[model samples]
Target: MVRAGFLLSIFLSMALVPASARASDPDPWFGHDKFLHFSVSNGLAAGGYAVSSLFWEGRTERLIAGGSFSLALGAAKELYDMTGRGDPSWRDFTWDVIGTATGLALAWGIDELFFRSDARKPVEAAATPGGLAIRW
Candidate 1:
């Protein structure tokens, strides 16, 4: 996740700011490119971190795993935009990671709120779906 975030950050903050999306716009953020950049970066980072936390600690290995996933997701998103009518840019990748990182924080906060007492499990685990059960 960290690696992905880093790559996305670079793509958005540097790669696309002055190049791509010159005549394009993002849906959620509208014409605000900065918003897109941060959103993507945090989203990808957080998502990767969340997935890794499912099977590993938030250590180096876990972080790396998350980063790798983030990178792949970022690539996929770019590819999606490329094939679609949307404008694809490196900056978009940056925003994805920012969004991912934000998601990670959100996930951690949720775990703390719903499963602070439960170790090595998701916050909501009725075994229904979203996360781990609280009672096991």
Candidate 2:
């Protein structure tokens, strides 16, 4: 039940982000914000995976699924941007992948760092307290 709800929420939220954006088309990009975006997205992806795989027990599989989903979703988003309502920026897609990876790393690092005193320390861990023994 919990896992279903989280999956539904994340997928739906992604769909909702640009219902109309998909109708149009996006242009390309010039500047770059790779590390920052990748890091944030990585953290977010990890957290998102934790939530979606609440019923699962294995950590490796959950991470792989999460990573696969993130990559596919990022590519899909880029495709949508090109065909539908976003810009045709392959660069952005690349960054999206990078970000997702970074976000996952950050989430893990945070968990390892501050998962003791306050569960809220790790952004990703905070998002999904499934395996965490967070006091709060």
Candidate 3:
């Protein structure tokens, strides 16, 4: 399915990291790479959760699937970097995890705010002459 292909693409991208740096002295962007990683990974995680929710039922399942995808992707990227000219920083991975948490919160908030299922609505009960009647 599309999810499988998407995951494969992510893994392929990680595998494509160059062994050597093509440019001299990559910019860290005012030493804010950690922040960038945090925010970007957070967004990626949220997006993954949102997408997974479309295919998976139940909040817990969606959260687990999306979170696992995000974490695996982040770890894979870091591991790939370690093999290249780029040094793998645990600090970056920490930020990625924080970002994933933020993303889950965001996804949950959005689901609660806009995508709540009506199936959870309470059923109504009416007293009848013989017994109680339930209405959904």
TM-score of each: 0.43, 0.49, 0.67
Q: Give candidate 1 misplaced runs (Cα > 4 Å).
A: 1-34, 97-136
RMSD of every prediction: 18.7, 22.0, 18.0
Supply candidate 3's per-residue lDDT for 91.
79
Q: Model 1, range 83-132, lDDT digits (tens) per residue?
A: 98667887777666666666666666765676554355544545647764
Query: Tens digit of lDDT per residue, candidate 3, span 38-91?
Result: 888898888888899889878888788768888898999899999986778887
10 residues in a row with least lDDT, candidate 3: 21-30
Ranking by lDDT: 3, 1, 2
Question: Any idea how many clashes model 1 has?
Answer: 31
How much lDDT does each candidate structure score?
0.66, 0.64, 0.83
Which runs in model 2 stand beyond 4 Å of their true positions? 1-40, 111-136
* The best candidate in terms of lDDT: 3
